[model samples]
Target: AYVITSRCAGFKDGACREVCPCDCIYDAGEQFVINPDDCIDCGACVTACPVEAIFADIDLPAEHSAALHFNRAFFES
Candidate 1:
């Protein structure tokens, strides 16, 4: 599943929302969520997040500083 990471927590800038071709990303009270089932893994949202909060699950940084992965996965499953 695709995941969003800490780099983009509580972000509402919505550049990602505008760019997602599949509309897989949703706005949460705390953060943005990527619906894995709907996600085409197009990586548009990744580039859209100015904070760099989006990443593939396996691509998460070693520091684990963000909730992007957890937030996306939490709703995905």
Candidate 2:
């Protein structure tokens, strides 16, 4: 799963969603989120984000780790 960090909060560019082969990326009001269960870990969205806000779960920066949980919560709720 890839998490969208704070840098993407206002961007909502949708580039990640456009290139996602699984269609896992979705609009979550403030930012785009990736559905962990549906994501294929293809790394396409990572490169598509102009803000460089997407990060793989394991590779997520310490400051942006909360984004991972936020992403999962979006799907859970």
Candidate 3:
């Protein structure tokens, strides 16, 4: 699972969607979200995000960043 963090927690410009290989990204109101099932973990959307908000579950460096996993799950469920 991956997440868009505070670094990329602003407007949902969808640059990530443009580069997503699996089309897993979803527009979640004010931000963008990734569907856990659809995401291939290709990491393509990470670089496409202008704010660098995207991160893999194991790569999050901060405690708050952990929320991305749940966020993705919630969006998918």
Best by lDDT: 2
Q: Against the hidden reference, what TM-scores do the models get?
A: 0.73, 0.95, 0.77
Which should have the higher lDDT, number 2 or number 3? 2
Weakest 10 consecutive residues of candidate 1 by summed lDDT: 64-73
User: By descending lDDT, how would the candidates be arranged?
Assistant: 2, 3, 1
Instruction: Give stretches of model 3 more than 4 Å off.
Output: none
Ranking of candidates on TM-score, top first: 2, 3, 1
Model 1 alpha-carbon drift over 4 Å, by segment: 65-69, 72-77
Q: Tens digits of per-residue lDDT for model 3 on 36-67?
A: 76778888888777777788878877865656
Clashes of 3: 0
Which lDDT value does model 1 have at 12?
69
- Report every candidate's CA lDDT: 0.71, 0.89, 0.73
Q: Indicate whether candidate 1 or candidate 2 has the larger TM-score.
A: 2
Which RMSD values do the candidates have, in order? Answer: 2.7, 0.7, 2.1
lDDT of 2 by residue, 1-77 (tens): 77888889888888999999989988888888888999989999999999999999999999998898889899997
TM-score of 2: 0.95
Q: Output the better candidate (1/3) by lDDT.
A: 3
